[model samples]
Target: MTRPDVTLENYDDVYRFYLDHQQNRLLARAAYAALSARFRPRVRYADGARDRLRELLSSDTRLIVVANHLSDRDQYTLAATAWRTPLRRAVGRTRVLAKDELFVDPGLRRKIDMMGSIPVFRSKNHGLRAVADAGRRMMDVSAQRLHRGDVLAIFPEGTCNEGDPTRVQRINTGVGHIAVKARKLGTAPALLAIGISYGPDRSADVHVAAPVLELPGTPMDVTRLVTAELQGAVDHAVAAR
Candidate 1:
């Protein structure tokens, strides 16, 4: 299937295309296998972090995993690190919320699509007024995916933290909105915040927190909860590094 153009005009179709698409499991595993040998060795987790994540994955509870973005390579690092832990269980089923521009390159887009990435139209790129409706559609599809039992991985910071990698940037309310929408659709999703930090040896330190099951009343309130959890996760990752 030809991918729809990642433009405002094709936004709806682009998202819908991925929503119904089933990834080739064999291909997904192959890709992970190739990267794991390199990344698995370089990535370390906080003590008990792996066990915490493993327990969550063992349950029927749906997860919304949010992480702080430190670099463009964060996704790759996360992917590789996950392959060594329980996170690899959600490999083919996870829908990653990625920025719109990542889909522009045809070559990379195929891999992105196969990895179950959903394009996110950001207001910074298209202007607030322009991406308003399209953003809603993105969130709706995300919520629907969650309701369908797919794990969602998002960099709630939205962009890499170029200034202070130690601190988690302000998280957007989009995450909260998606979780709220999923809840409305009868899916009680749990939040899992992961923190990533690079060490002097270039190894990655990843800290995964136990899932936060209780959410606050409004979207903003949920966002605040996520903010606090993510910051604590980041601090753990840094200290571990």
Candidate 2:
């Protein structure tokens, strides 16, 4: 049977299918490494970030990596960074959140799906009820992934920043919502912040902010903490350029 067309209103079903039929890990890793290397990102680890990551890995803690989106290739950059660092051990279980529109293109969707991408429909693109429903499912799926011990790398800003490279755009509350959900679930994932800067030549400087060691009670609390951390990482990375 031919699959039904997926729209913003019903993309959740499509996402569920992909989640169940996850991509091949070996293929995903190999492709990620090749793409990231071609993009040629220089990853800079903040003081103790590496050690902290290793510690988290040693204890088998799942990670929720948040970052400022710079370009369409940000996913590849972060994938390459993880593949090159101690986080390499966790690549097999890592999943990146990709906007739903990317999944609508046949050729691109194939590639995106193979990269262990989870589909996300942004509320900003739709009416209130549909967006609200999709947004809730997105957060629930994110929290579920964390509960399953998968590494989830997300762009909390939900899109690339076109205005100012050094300044982070207004973040959506999804990250905070995910954190709050985790709080209630009693299994909060380790929150990691990242900042990436692209030069005129397309070379990237990626910075890893120190992970938030603790989560606050409210969604706004989590939002403030992650926002401040990401902003700092962005500024530090841009200043280094």
Candidate 3:
């Protein structure tokens, strides 16, 4: 089925498009294959991480995957690692929250669509007041997706941490908001933090932390927890690299 053509001008239209979006298995498989071939990353899940994730994938518990921002290539490496690990189970079932600008180009949009990306109108790109309503809509769509059994992935840092690759930058509360919304929608999402580091050997090292089942209620509290977990995961990835 051909995906709907969404200009992303109307927030409601964009929300509807995602709510009704169909997963194209062939395209998703091809993209994952290409990512695996392009960047063959070595993945190392923290002790019991794989088992914990397996349980989550097998259960009805939805996961709000949060990761640190390292480089633009982080997404590619992360995808490649997932393809090589148990995360491949969620290959076609995950919805990634991506910046809206990435959907502007037709060619890139097609690839991103195949990857199940949900366009996010970030306040950094648009003024806080301008994107406020749209941001809420996007978060609602995201929560609905989770409630409907789609795994949600987000980069809490919002942008690449160019200052220090080893240290995780301050996380934006957007991820917290998404989690809180998901909880309100009765999803009660679990947190899964993945850390990525490129080693001196030019090999990508990924550290998947154990899932956090207990989540705080407020957005600020959730953001603080995510920041701490992500930083720990990143520290492990850097040390193991």
lDDT values for all models = 0.84, 0.79, 0.84
- The window of 10 residues in a row where model 2 has the poorest summed lDDT is 1-10
Off by over 4 Å in 3: 1-9, 200-202
lDDT per residue for candidate 3 within 87-130, as digits (tens), equals: 77888888988888888889999888889999887777777898
Output the lDDT of residue 241, model 3: 65
Clashes of 2: 0
Give the deviation of candidate 2 from the true structure as CA RMSD. Answer: 2.0
* lDDT of model 1 at position 204: 81
TM-score of 1: 0.93
lDDT of 3: 0.84
lDDT of 2 by residue, 13-111 (tens): 765664455578898878878876687677888899989998998887878888888888788788877877777877667778888888788888878
Error of 3 at 82 (Å): 1.7
Clashing pairs in 1: none
Candidate 1 lDDT by residue in tens digits, 1-241? 6668998878878877877777787787777767777765344555676777778778867889998998887888777766777888888888899998989999998898777889998887888999999989999999999888789999998888989889888889999999999999999888888888887776788877767878886899999999999998888888875
Per-model TM-score on C-alpha atoms: 0.93, 0.92, 0.93
